[model samples]
Target: MIVLFIVLGGLLWLISLLLFAFSAWASYKLMRLLWGKIRRALLRPGTAQITSYEVFTPDPEDIHVQDTRPQIRLELDCERHGQRFQVSLGPLTCEELFPALDLPAHHIACWLSDEDWRQLLEKRWVTIACDWRLRKAILTSQIRNDRRLLLISFLSLSLFALTVTLSLLPH
Candidate 1:
């Protein structure tokens, strides 16, 4: 009877460990998949159109013509062209665009200009080859990390199970 209890407890513990390890692996895989999609979007040749644009201000009134200074202007350039267009962007939207453009959020504002904005608007096909190339690199790194995590988890779980099973056998 004591042996039976010991074996059952050990099995339950092993199962729980396996479950946790798998969950972590799944999380890593999901992150990698998302990173892949982002990389593709960024790296594909041609300008991605400016699908949308926004300007965000904590106080709407701050954006009013009467206001002397605005905190920052956010632009959403979906197209890869160097055209000019007016688009509004909020802080959150800026964050979302960073991964898509493969550029740091801080650098985005610097790239904005009247001529560039006009070009972006005029260029129907915005080539984002540079962005895409950078994205590809990032995705590759993510995939490598995910693979490493999976390998580690599988090995740990196997070793643990083996140890438990051997311990339970007659010596």
Candidate 2:
């Protein structure tokens, strides 16, 4: 019975180490894609038209805090070319747009920027040159606030140490 516990713990510890390694590799790749690949790309377009926009919020599991990231979808008008496209940027917070937010939230509608919305509304066409793949953004966010990940790392190390100590004990 004791041997089974030790073996299971050892396996989990090894798995956590592999997971940590993968996370590091993924983070490195995401940063490279976000900055290195698009260093010269323009973040904003000279002209953009906001035909429509909608804000979305998922059901909150707890009253204390929201669960899902807030998102907004914008349908842009391409008047000069005669085609329409949609662009979205979300899971935003006050820190992303204005001076700062008192608390950081994964979801903030439009970064609470009326001026930004006005800018989009004023223009008849819009373009985004430097937007990254959604996958990259998700990975970046995971790395930014990885509480569960850190916990797993610590647990893994402790398990490893415990397994070593157990093996050293008398049979």
Candidate 3:
């Protein structure tokens, strides 16, 4: 009976230790995942400093040079200081450029000079993409929360089993 009690106690201790270890591992994994998400959010395209520019459909009068097509054009315009420049955007595609432009639904398509156009595009793309990614991260966090809860429950159950086995052993 003494031997049985010792054995049972030892088993319980081992099981509890294992449960604690697993719980710690799960927590570490969760922390790493959160860190990765934060890093990605900070570093992904458009999240960092503005790097490029674009021009959507511009008014013919506003455009210094006119082209037959009305497409949106993206240009690298970081160096042009205050000078109004014009670039011909061949054609405007609402689906492809609207989200990138971050224009309001009620806003009308108007002409913007090359400089103003670049600034607007840089601001629009950064703002929209950041918002979209934040929403996506929130959804992913919700799912991960559920998984973490399940892992905790499993760990608790293992601990419970250890306690029960110890109690049932003969004195």
Who wins the lDDT comparison?
1
Lowest summed lDDT over 10 consecutive residues: which window, candidate 3?
131-140
- Where in model 1 is the C-alpha error above 4 Å? 1-4, 7-14, 17-42, 48-52, 59-171
Question: Judged by lDDT against the true structure, how good is candidate 2?
Answer: 0.48
Model 3 agreement with the true structure over 1-171: per-residue lDDT tens digits: 999999999999999999999999999998887665444444333321234444444567765746433355443212123332322221444344454345552234444466655565664322212223233211222334555765686799999999999999998
In candidate 1, what residue range of length 10 has the lowest lDDT sum? 132-141
lDDT to native, each model: 0.49, 0.48, 0.48
Estimate the lDDT of model 1. Answer: 0.49
Tens digits of per-residue lDDT, candidate 2, 4-113, equal: 99999999999999999999999999877655434323222333444665545456785765545444444543322454444443443323422111224333444446
RMSD of 1: 11.8
| Residue pairs that clash (backbone atoms under 3 angstroms), model 3 | 58-111, 59-111, 69-90, 70-90, 70-91, 70-92, 71-90, 71-91, 71-92
TM-score of 2: 0.30
RMSD of each: 11.8, 12.8, 16.6
Q: Who wins the TM-score comparison?
A: 3
